[model samples]
Target chain A: MSATVDVAVIGATGAVGEALVQVLEERDFPLKTLHLLGVDEAVGHSVTFRGKNLRVRAADEFDFANVQVAFFVDEADVTRECLEAVRRGGCAVIDLSAGLPAGQAPIVVADVNPQVMASLKAPYWVSSPAAVSVALSCVLAAIAGQVEVTRASVTACLAVSSRDRQGVTELARQTAELLNARAMEPRLFDRQIAFNLLAQVEEPDNSGHGALERRIGNELKTLLTRPQLKVAVTCIQAPVFFGDSLNVSLQTEAAVDIPAVCAALDASPAIEYVEPGDYPTAVGDAVGQDVIYVGRVRGGIEDEREVNLWITSDNVRKGTAVNAVQLAELLIKDHLSKILT
Target chain B: MSATVDVAVIGATGAVGEALVQVLEERDFPLKTLHLLGVDEAVGHSVTFRGKNLRVRAADEFDFANVQVAFFVDEADVTRECLEAVRRGGCAVIDLSAGLPAGQAPIVVADVNPQVMASLKAPYWVSSPAAVSVALSCVLAAIAGQVEVTRASVTACLAVSSRDRQGVTELARQTAELLNARAMEPRLFDRQIAFNLLAQVEEPDNSGHGALERRIGNELKTLLTRPQLKVAVTCIQAPVFFGDSLNVSLQTEAAVDIPAVCAALDASPAIEYVEPGDYPTAVGDAVGQDVIYVGRVRGGIEDEREVNLWITSDNVRKGTAVNAVQLAELLIKDHLSKILT
Candidate 1:
């Protein structure tokens, strides 16, 4: 690993991509040059990074020859395409997508499974979990530690931003129109997103895996190494623009004493436990941070042996970009590049 | 049972009280005369019932004499005081508060366990479940059918209105202010209630049972007739103003079939299934309905035998006043008044 490396961030105009640029700069990652890639529509746009205006280039036209490490922040298809190009160009590709088509050892949250990337072969990819689930999984992994997670259920109060830039804009437009006594129609969401909540996120497949669910399940499996864990999720869309809040219940293999759980959570670097009577974690509280905020820990009813938790995190940060950047930092620290490629 | 009965509704200014008045009129329950009682501030205030302006009388000044039934909708202390007075007046009291002092049966949803009330030999006391839990428990009980509820977990998305009238006003005012670019402060909830979700409702007791949990557990035990059944609950405040939504997971004592559970739910008269892919029930959809709206039924993970469901009901309607009124109607039809007073 060099003191400074050439890095490329794909899907530069998207929400997570924008956060990726900011996170790299905020974390002071040593970068020789930063390449921003997006669709043709965003080609002429420029985002200021480290006091320099970096013009976005179309992913189809971008050259990956000199890019030592590339962060694929686009959709799964685009990411798959870019991974091939970057790998062929002899560059390490960190994919923040569902998974690298089977043979690739895709790195998950470096904190949870940093050792998985030690032998990074070709197409070095790191798949991040869905914004809502990753935060909880990361926090839980940090505190719970190797415990059998039997039953897990999550009810997500998702932000419109989960859809895309258009979703966020639609929320603002609908809210403004509704408040002004104007007729508001649903666009990004199935129903009104102004001062309301909708329960379904992605259309459920017969296999019970929506896009978000698949991502959550796959990423958690990669991070926690438990592929058979039982996870029931109900993702809801709230009127908020950014942070995602999840009410999660976990039935563990062993009894979870609340005090012990609290102590473990308090000691974790990636999680902050808000006291029971303190201001409970909400969307507003998590809008701009990188840490997963966990509070409101309680015992399960039928299984008093299990523990339930309420977790919230900036979906764009800890869920996506910040986590990707954190993985890059771990790779650099572990000096794994000497063994790969 | 008598063909005619005199009834008084205490705490007439609140959400539940308002719904109670509407329920009385909607059912036209053999009322010879109706009296509305409230605190000192609400005295002389008028509430319209069946097109007649009924002036609210002070709880202390309201006459309980000759009243066949008194519905106590105030705080526990207030309900306790009213019950003592009503009992002295030889009138039966259906107390909505937890202050009934333990000996009497806290009649949850009368439809689910009307037998609990039937076994009570005493006059002057009946109780109801908490608004949120009763809605889900009623649905579960209808399906479980005397099967032991081994474990039940509820993640409640409670409306601001659940906090009381002032909470409702605060939510509306703060939301408007937020939309108008005006700064707002938290009042009804521990945090901002406009565009965010707060994960804790009431302060959690040292035992992890908040006010919401205690009420739900008490209600479920009485309704299921399983005094020892365990219930774990996490109640959160959402942006919704009136309806309470719960994502519940439960394991029953019987081998549960998803199709059979769905059939039982469909057959239950007081519940309406909000089908999957249909607009998931929100607070606005349940503001004035009498039936508990349930949807998104799915099988549990690992234990394909367990079930998970999403339930939403107008907390003020089916959860409180409507259910109470429905009980009164059943009592009239069953001639349960032969044992009263």
Candidate 2:
């Protein structure tokens, strides 16, 4: 932790990637140099870091050996392509993409399972869970010691930004066209997402689970260290521009102590617990926040063992960028010396 | 079946009320006279029934005794105020506003529990469940015969129209204002309902359950006749304007038979079972439809006893108007003599 560390951010031009860079600056990371890199489409874009514009370079041409850590914020394919280079350079990898499966790298959420980092050796590789998983896990982790969660059902209403820049542009265009009483074809999404909810963000496999849905479920189990926990997930695309709204219901082994749950949530650094009377919405509360907003907390209508929660999290800021940056902080605090050696 | 029936529709200017009139006309109900009644605000408006303009008269002045049955489609308060008059008028009541408690009037979904109608005595009063309840009950009922549902967790993504015409107008106004970068105050909803997801549709009770959420849970229990079945519901307001989208996960007593479940859903005349891979959306598949569109049907990620489904239903059409009309038809077919006498 003595010397400043050098880091590279892949896919620097996308929404989450840009937010990652901004977070790094805002958090004042101990960085000697910042490498902004992306695929060919993003090569010409420039991102501001520490009040200086850094041009995004071609990721394939960048030398990963120059940096001690690399944040893979690109799509899965790009991450898969650059994994070997980062491993060869002996750089610690914090993947925002679900490129490396759980077996390849343990999924880590800084607020939930930072202790998982202790087992990793040099050139550490960690996978960051999806935004919904990150938000849910943090809240779940805060209260896990009080009650054993038996099962959870989550309905993730994802913002257009979850699909990145193209998604944001399409939503704006579609909404404008519809407002103007003009019919327009949907691009990026399968159907009209301007004022409609797309049931699945992506095409489901033969088993009918959306890719993101399965990923969130798996990530929650891994991050929470409860492999046997039954997690049901449904990821639907919302018309929202920037936040992910989740409707979560959990069943615990015993009756949930309402006061204790609220106390735990309010005490968590990574969560902002909203009171019962007032609730949070994605646009109204979580659009640019660093912490996930949790509200409308209540027990089941009949079963005291059940708990319901509404969570709104900024998909780019808290969900991806902040968590990834936080993971980097943990890496530097505990494993910096190992990586530098 | 014996003779044409006379009917009165209170609150004939609202979205559901108008749709109810259309459905009645489309179904070609055996009708000698149709009475469209409303409050002071609706007194000047007129609804077209069977190709003729029917003026909406003041409901407080209208004699309910003129009609054999009355469809109360106004607010809960209005419905409550008119209940005694309707009862004194000896007019059978189908309360769509949920004004009367289940004890006073049995909540019924035509497709799921038409048998409940047989239990009613003369001047029968029945309550049409909420849109979410009606849609979910129909789907759950179709599969309940095959698998004993031990528990269910539902995320009801409601469209703006659920709030009625005002809600629709407010959403359009908000979206327009936001798009134009004009800051405007939220009208009906607490916050922006244009491009955001509101965690709860209404002010939740002290227990943290929204009124609609609790009602849906109770209605499902009564409709399925599974009083002991555990039902958890979260009702959220989505940006969509017309259809109500529901994400339902059910845990059965035994492992779900996917093929059998599909067969039952397809066989049911009340639902249009969508195959895997292709899903139904609120605007694309369910709006203006008579049947609820069911899609994204699958088993759980790891558990075989779990089944998940996505349902999009026309909240104004199938959820309320169609169900109410069907209930009227049911009453007329069976209790024509009882009512006329």
Candidate 3:
């Protein structure tokens, strides 16, 4: 196995795409050729990866046969046929779209179920859950081994970047305009999200749960493999530009020892547990961090059977791009390199 | 009984104080001489009431004997001895501080237990819970009658104005500076609250629960008079300037009907229910409103005995100032009128 791997990154000019390019450089991804594909409008726009200025080309011209690995990062109109073509060409594709087709691929979080994901034998495509779910799945997996989680409830505060670059730019403009005592109109969200809290991140359905709220629950169930875990999530669009913050509470099958729970969490590789006094916050602790920052472990006043945790993670850096890179690394080492000659 | 009632508003120079002046004007409270008393720094400052301007006098120098009703708006250095002086002068006082003397008077939320509060015969000083507590307490009280709440958990996303005037101004300055790539220091809170979320609104203790968190529980237990009804609160300082948004979860003794719960909420005057798809948000629905905005009602999938709701209210207007004014109205009509000369 001596040939270098060729890679193509679709939607390469977007937020996750930008992060993927940086991660590729930082990790020195083993590649013979790196192709940056974007929309027709971004044809001449260039991105620097490993000190190489590569002009973006339209994805319509991309040849999947040459793409040993492809990253789908933007919410561009990707079709089943396009994905099938990439799959038929033996490309290891990682999707980070709003959602993926049911039973399409082994949906995964790298830290949670890496071994199973690594041993894939066929030309495959996998999908990463939303940023919030990716961060939360790690913590739940870490704790599930030590404590039997009977039920779970999560209140996720998503940052502006969860919507992408335009969301961030709009928040920047609106924040400035509002601070200057000028009225600012909402473009991406239904409410003024610059200096306010939008209670529902997506439209509410008949069940009174927003689309984003339902997605978090669905993805958590899929990742944890506990279909009846009693998951309830409320996604709030906060004003912050980065880091997904969550207030998570879980009811275990039995009473919990506070110190033991903290010890188990500290032992988890993907979790960074801060001491009580220095509580983990979105900007102060979690924005640039790779692992989920967790603190403020609390037990009930009289009953120790329940616990509350505060957690945060960089939604784009770690949640989407870094996880995608890790998954690709696992794929190449286990299966893709075997085909190289 | 026919003469207008004289009232003194002590510490009338804070955020709640500003809202107090406006609510009194809005409600057209029966008044004779509306005395505005402040600390020495605000001595010559004048506040308007019904097109009449009154200069602020030092609260320490004001005669309590002339006070028919007094509302404490600021969290200044209040003392038990000073409070005793007002009680000895036969004045009725309403304190808006954190901890009022136990057994001093009944701690009250106006809409929740108005009849009992109004019927108190003793000349007294009563305390009102914070705005977030005020909003949640009303909803809990309304539902407590229909179903027995075994336990409850709340995640309160408090607005910047929850801190005070400096908080609002700091957010204004920080929002502008952060947009321009300039860092602004935290002046009122423990962290940068503009475009960010502070995990803990108060200092942590042995339990890792912040002071605000503990206060919410302690106050709820006392208000509901159900010391065993488990309560846990996580207070997050959000960037919004006015509304307090909270995610509430409850475990009732029996299964809950979603529509019936919505109907019960709508039947309560203090709660304003928002239908699904039109979920109530902080800036869009709750800010400046008098009622607690409730939306997103959902029952647990596996266990119908549990329920979740999203609520918001103007922490200053209805949370603090409006409740104080309403308490005064009850005091004057049911208790003070019997003692009037």
Compare the candidates by DockQ and give the number of the best one. Answer: 2
**Any runs in candidate 2 off by more than 4 Å, and if so which?**
A337-341, B337-341
Docking class of 3: medium
Q: Compose the digit string of candidate 3's lDDT tens values, residues A1-341.
A: 34568888887888878888898888778878999987767777999987889999877667789888888886736534366667567777788875357776777899988876765657677888889888888988988766788777788999889888987887888887877788777787777877678777777777777767777888888889888788878888888888989998888899887788888889998899987877777787787677889888888765688888899899988898989888888887778777875
In Å, residue B127's CA in model 1 sits off its true spot by 0.9
User: Compared with the real two-chain complex, what DockQ does model 2 have?
Assistant: 0.88
By TM-score, the candidates rank as 2, 3, 1
Higher-ranked by lDDT: 1 or 3: 3
Candidates sorted on lDDT, descending: 2, 3, 1
Task: Indicate the docking level reached by candidate 2.
Answer: high
Compute the lDDT for candidate 1. 0.74
> Where in model 3 is the C-alpha error above 4 Å?
A1-4, A79-81, B1-3, B79-81
What are the per-residue Cα lDDT tens digits for candidate 1 across B1-341? 35778888888878788889988888777788888898868788888899989999888866688677778888888877766677678766776766688866456576587765555544636777788766877787778753345777778888878877988788778878977888788775667877788877777777565776777776777677777676777888878777888877777777667777778888888788755456456645766888887877766545665677778888888888877776666555554456443
Predicted structure 1, TM vs. truth:
0.94
TM-score winner: 2
Chain A, model 2: TM: 0.97
Candidate 1 on A1-341: residue-level lDDT in tens?
A: 45577898888888888899999999899787999988758788998899889999888877787777788878778876766677677776677765467646464675567777665555455566567656866776876553557767777788888887988899888877876789777787777777677767777665333567656755565567777777777777887788888888787888777787888788888887777666445566778898888887767655656787788888888888988887777666555445332
lDDT of 3 at A319: 90
**What interface root-mean-square deviation (Å) does model 2 yield?**
0.7
TM-score winner, 2 or 3: 2
Per-model DockQ: 0.49, 0.88, 0.69
